[model samples]
Target: MQPLILHIPHASTHIPFKDGYLVGEELLQQEINKLTDWYTDDLFDSPEDITIKADFSRIFCDVERFVDDQQEVMAQYGMGMLYTHTDAGQRMREVNPTLRKQIKEEYYLPHHQKLEVAVKKQLDQFGHALMVDCHSFTDIPFERDLNKKVPRPDINIGTDPFHTSQTLQDLTLEFFTSRGFSVGLNWPYSGTMVPMAYYQKNRQVQSILIEVNRKLYLDAVTCTRNRHFNEIKSVLNQYLHLIRSNVNDIFYPINNES
Candidate 1:
C-alpha cells in the first residue's frame, strides 16, 4: 500500500510593513545574495541538480501569499512591526506566547484533524498507514532576522524515541546517517511535533518526524534552496524504503486512541 505521507510546509512569522502587505513580490535576487556565502557553499559548491533553486523560489513566493495581511498574519506569530504609538502591536508583542499557542491550535489543529480523517480513510482501504512529518530547521536559531524565523537544528528525528522501542530509534538513527545526513536525537526539537501532533490519535498510526536542518536545503537569510537539496531528497528516498520494509519489526503501535 502507498503510505500516507503528509509534508507540512513551514509557516513562518509574517513581517508587517508599516504600509501593509507586499503583494506578488519576487524574491529570487534577494535569495541569490543571501545564499551564496553560508551552508550551501560549505557543503556542495557545485551540485548536479537544477531543480533546487526552484524549490526555494516556490517557498519564497508562497510564504508571502499565505499570510497576506499585517494584523491577521502577524497574529500567527504574536508579533508585529514596531508601532510605539499603537497598543495592538504592543499587545501582540506582550501576549505573544499565548497568542502563538492559539495560532498553533488554529493552524495546526485543523491540519491534524484533516490528517486524521484522511489517514482513517486510507486505513479503511489499506488497514494501516505511515506518516513521515517532514520539516527543515536551521543549524542554529535566528534570533533577530528581519524575516522572523524560529531557530532549528542540523537534524532532529522525533518519534517519542525515549518512550518507544529502542530498536526503532536505532534503525532511524543508523538509517539516516547511512543515507548521508548528520543526524541528531532530538537535540533541537523533541517528539511532540511528530507523534503528539499528527500521530497522536493512535499507535496504529506510525509517525516519524524528519527534521532536516535548513542549512541542508537553503540559504538562511535569503531563503534560497541549496544546490545540495536534490541529493538530500535522493538519500531520503532510500531511507524511506528501509523504513517501509521494517515497519512490522520496528514500529510498536500505540493502538489505544484517546
Candidate 2:
C-alpha cells in the first residue's frame, strides 16, 4: 500500500515579501494570527506519511485557492489564490497584474508543482494516491465565511464528488464520530485539494479535507497550543495509521467472483 500524502497548505506564518501588502506589520500579524492554520504541520504529522506543506503564509499566497480568480468563489471576497483583501473586507494588498504574476511564480506555482510531483510519484509506484488535505479552522466564523452559524462542530470533513468515494466518506465519518468528535460534512468549509492535472480526470487520485476546529487544541485568543494539543496530535497519528492499514479496502476493494 502507498503511504498517505498530507497536503498542509496554510500552516506557515512566513511573509516572503511585503511589496504589495498595504497593511502594517502589526495589522498583518493580526490577520496572520487569525488566518494561519496554527500548528497544523505538527498537528497532522505522521512518521510514514508524505507531507507537502506550503512554506509561505497564506497571507502571502494561498496554495489552496484556484489559480484563476474567475473559477474561485472566494475571489469575490478578495481572498483568492493571492488575497488582496482581509477577512473584514479591508484592502490589505495592491495586487497589480505584474505583482500577481510575480507572486504566482515565486510562491503559488512551486507549491503546486511539489504537490503534483508527489502525487505522480505515488501513482507511478502504487497505481493510486490518497491525499489528506490537512487544515484547522477557527471556531468563530470569519466575516467572509459562507457559513456564519454559531456553534460549529469539532471536526469537519470536506469531500470531492469525483475524488472522494462513498466508502471513504463513510469511513471518515465513522473514524471521527467513534472517537466522540462532533463531525460535520462540509459545514463551514467544503471541497478537497487535487492537483489540476488529475482533478476530475483521475479516479486513482483520491483526496479528502480534514478541518479540525481550533478550539479543540488551540488557545484562540493567544494563538497558542492548548493543553489538548498533544492529545489531538495523537488522535491524528492514529487516523493516519487507520488510513494506511485500510488503504486496499478503501481504494481497491477486492470483489469475490460469485
Candidate 3:
C-alpha cells in the first residue's frame, strides 16, 4: 500500500441535519455555494492513496479548525469548528454549548479519528507517511480573509517546519514552477494537516498542503468546471505520480535506516 494520506476537508455540500441555522434554505444554499470547496474530492482522487474526506459541508462543521476556539485563529471571526458567522460576518447559526458539543461528537471527532487511524496504519507499514492536505481556494478573496492580495498564484504550498523536509519543499516548488505555474509558499493560507496524536511529535509522519487556485480549474461564479479543468486535473495526477515515484528519495534517511 502507498504510504500517503489525502485529506480533502471542504469538498462536500451535504447537510445531514439542519438545526440552529439562522438563515432560510435559499440563503443557506448561497452560503454553501460560496464556502464549499467544489469538486476537490474528485480533483484529488487517487486509488493508490488513502483519502479521508468529510462527508458533510464545512458550513455544518469545519473539521480543520482547532477543537478549542482559543487555539484557532479563525475562531475570533466566529468561523471556528462550528461556524457561527458567515464570511460577511452575518449570523448563520446559533451554536450554543449543547449544539457545539453535539457537532463535535457527531462530526468533528469521528473525522479526526479516521485521520489518526490512516496515519498510524501508514506509519506501521512504511515507517513514514506523507499527508497531502488537498484543497482549492477562491481566486477572489473572501470578505473575512486575512490576506486581500489580488491575482493569487496558481498554487499555494503550505508546510510545517518539522514535518516538511527541505527536499520535499524544493521538489514541490520545482514540480509546479517547471510547468510554468506561479507558486506561493504559505502565502494566503498556511499549515498542513497533521493528526493531533502525531502533530509536532513525529517527524516520520510528513505533511504538505497543496491549495490550487479555483480560477485554474473552475468557473468560480457558476461553481462549474471550466476549459482548463481537465488540464489542471491531469497536471495534479502527474504531481501525485511524481511524489509516489520519489517517496524513497523524499523520506530519505528514515527509509535508509529502516
Return the top candidate by lDDT: 2
Better by lDDT, candidate 2 or 1: 2
Tens digits of per-residue lDDT, candidate 1, 37-69, equal 223222322232111111222112221122323
Candidate 2 lDDT by residue in tens digits, 1-258: 569999999999998879988989888998999999999999998879899999999999999898899999999999998889988889999999998899898789999999999999999998889999999998899999999877999999999988887778888999999999999898889999999999998888889999999999999989999999999999989888888888777776412211
Better of 1 and 2 by TM-score: 2
Counted clashes in each candidate structure? 3, 0, 0
Score candidate 3 by TM-score against the native. 0.96
Please identify model 2 stretches exceeding 4 Å from their true place: 253-258
Sort the candidates on lDDT, descending order. 2, 3, 1
lDDT of 3: 0.89
Listed in order, each prediction's TM-score against the native is: 0.55, 0.97, 0.96
lDDT by residue (19-105, candidate 3, tens digit) is 899989988888898889889998888888889999999999999999999999999898899888888888988888998899899
- At residue 16, candidate 3 shows an lDDT of 87
Looking at model 1, residue 151 earns an lDDT score of 47
- Higher-lDDT candidate among 1 and 3? 3
